[model samples]
Target: MQIVSTLRGLMLGLGISLAGAAAPAQAEMLDLEKDELKFGFIKLTDMAPLAIAYEKGYFEDEGLFVTLEPQANWKVLLDGVITGQLDGAHMLAGQPLAATIGFGTQAHIITPFSMDLNGNGITVSNEVWEMMKSHIPHENGKPVHPIKADALKPVIEKFRAEGKPFNMGMVFPVSTHNYELRYWLAAGGIHPGFYSEDNITGQIQAEALLSVTPPPQMPATLEAGTISGYCVGEPWNQQAVFKGIGVPVITDFEIWKNNPEKVFGITKEFADQYPNTTLAITKALIRAAKWLDENDNANRREAVEILARSQYVGADAEVIANSMTGTFEYEKGDKRAVPDFNVFYRYYATYPYLSDAVWYLTQMRRWGQITEHKSDDWYLDVAREVYRPDIYLEAARLVVEDGNAAEADFPWESDGFRAPQREFIDGITFDGRQPNAYLELFPIGLKGSQKIAQNAVVGG
Candidate 1:
């Protein structure tokens, strides 16, 4: 009887031990400054990190209860963050820089994490595509990847000769789309022109006639034949391919490899006041980024489903998946695998490198959004102010300490990855540390102290 009783006790103890071993470690409870959080995003696939963080309970995991709202447009979203109507937002890669530099709205917006990469494409209307196609070199009966704007140069010149303006659309003046469109054009020896104090809005001195059109409105504007082509993020670009009304000539990835796209933006005041909350949000976003890129992007299909929900990108699953799930359609029925088309986690995409900030600043200067000729130090100072690596390091450290990620995730010893990147479609290498030298490389843009002429200002 005693032995049987002892045996029963031993079995019970073993069972308890097994149960304890099977349980997952409890994540550290983060103290959030604001629990009822309002976040904003545009209807784009790159906004997936925010959606995944919310839907996957990553924010909740960090003790944050967030409400995601879709904003009317980029300006509204930026204004929302600035006015405290929204706590933070998924912002254009250039927003923080522009805001800090007083380009559009003057505020101290900063980004600690880059949202995603390679999510934009340049789409041409059918008429423009038809004309440009003849000039594009073909290989094996397919248009070459990283198709340069050289093909479209003749088309623009033809329009010029016919006494008609060649207009193109970008989401906003400070958007990556605008700079990329200009970059591609300049690289192909087509002058996309400059903007200065004389042309503060950057619409003047135009050769290709670039202007702002919202992302959702891009396809419709193109379909209406109001614009010949556009540079915007997906699924608008993919929408063009699906509608068979336009063709995506090139991706921003081709414009510049793994280029910085969007950022998780918040005012510096908010971040300074709620340091813990800021880190917590960053932690959640880091998890979302990992999920997006883990297992060689095995989760992208699932991500597309979440983004398809009305609260998020609000686009069709197929439309989001066309680019998000490792494939892109240049023309209708010309879908090809482009695995790195939308990177979230890999290549340290989440890391807010100072150089990434400087690159955008360089574009601002090149196109005359930055009117004054600032030194390399001025550019670096602005970049460092807007791109807070301190906050990023804190968030990354917390993730590592929590064992959710490893030390191998970030650059432990470096000066912020400022190496000369040489994989652009134009084959131009950009060394962010050397802004003047980099600017001088481009023949079509303003270099050191170069200003636009009075005649260049259209409506100013």
Candidate 2:
């Protein structure tokens, strides 16, 4: 375990002087409803916010006691939140959007906090890496960073020529891992098929087959040659580097800068029933986020330790810190500094932007997961429902009012984002308000109410 002393200093320094301010006369005292709470998370490093909040006493400081539990799968985790077995969980940015639209399991779940950005990587087996290495251009015999998927194009073709299907793994269908992997492959001119609800064809006609593999089993699955490569969250991708079984080709930050990854999700009913508790939890999370990003990520090493405990992420501190401590390992012994790789606090990481929600909706429409096309207004309405910026603002206001945070720490005048972001590997600039125009930019997706049946010639 990498116990960074500097991180301790950073967290302690930023620790809020909540003792100074009294509960305001006008402020509503947080109704102490459901003081003891259970939250769920998959065993991924980005769940750091929840772990850090508990470990650093942030939760208790907000007059809330919380227990964190590891969930078996994404579906199970979502179900727990819906049924109130768990108040919330670390979730895919797409999960709430998918559920609200009746895609898989319809539920009215929403999020106010986006956990972090850009903490995923694509890794290939050592044998496959060697094959891919031949095509990649190098500078001074060192493999390039942000390696494109073009190099793997020929490898997949070779497997197809030999009558073998090229298979890859992602955490889940609606997961950021799946989309990031698809985006990387497609940007390199490799077609990663599509899904139409009406079409029973499980095959999306992808050039390289994509499937789901549990995070802990990713390395084993790759070692068994079941999957040539995979897109997954930390410690898993970093685990491959430690085992020397694989080399990470690209990080998601390289694919799309500052892409939204996970969210702290809760049902709308839960929020309405316990609004004060809701704000209290959000307050604790805000403090934890501050601790993580304070002093330019000096607290990450300590956070990695807390996440390593058996009750939380339960991974080795070294494994967790490999990516958590502002660096990532690709090939064995090839460690590089990637400061924003596992961001928890900076760049308003705690703020859940409506544009982030819209982006995920656009991806769903792009891939035919959303069977019908809707107008820009519809997109905004859905985004507004799921991504609660108003609630977040309220929480931030309370923390600031309580002297737990400075007024200068937040974006008081944030216009969601400065401009249309154009950093994607495909170079597509996405404007959140213009979903229809964005849909028109894609070459391989449905747009303008284009139905799957219309594209098929029955007798051909």
TM-score of each: 0.92, 0.91
Model 2: number of clashes? 0
C-alpha local distance difference test of each model:
0.85, 0.82
Could you tell me the TM-score of candidate 1?
Answer: 0.92
lDDT leader: 1
Each candidate: RMSD: 8.5, 5.6
Stretches > 4 Å off in candidate 2: 1-29, 199-202, 415-418, 454-460
Clashing pairs in 2: none
Error (Å) of candidate 1 at residue 205 is: 2.4
Scanning candidate 1 in windows of ten residues, the lowest lDDT window is 1-10
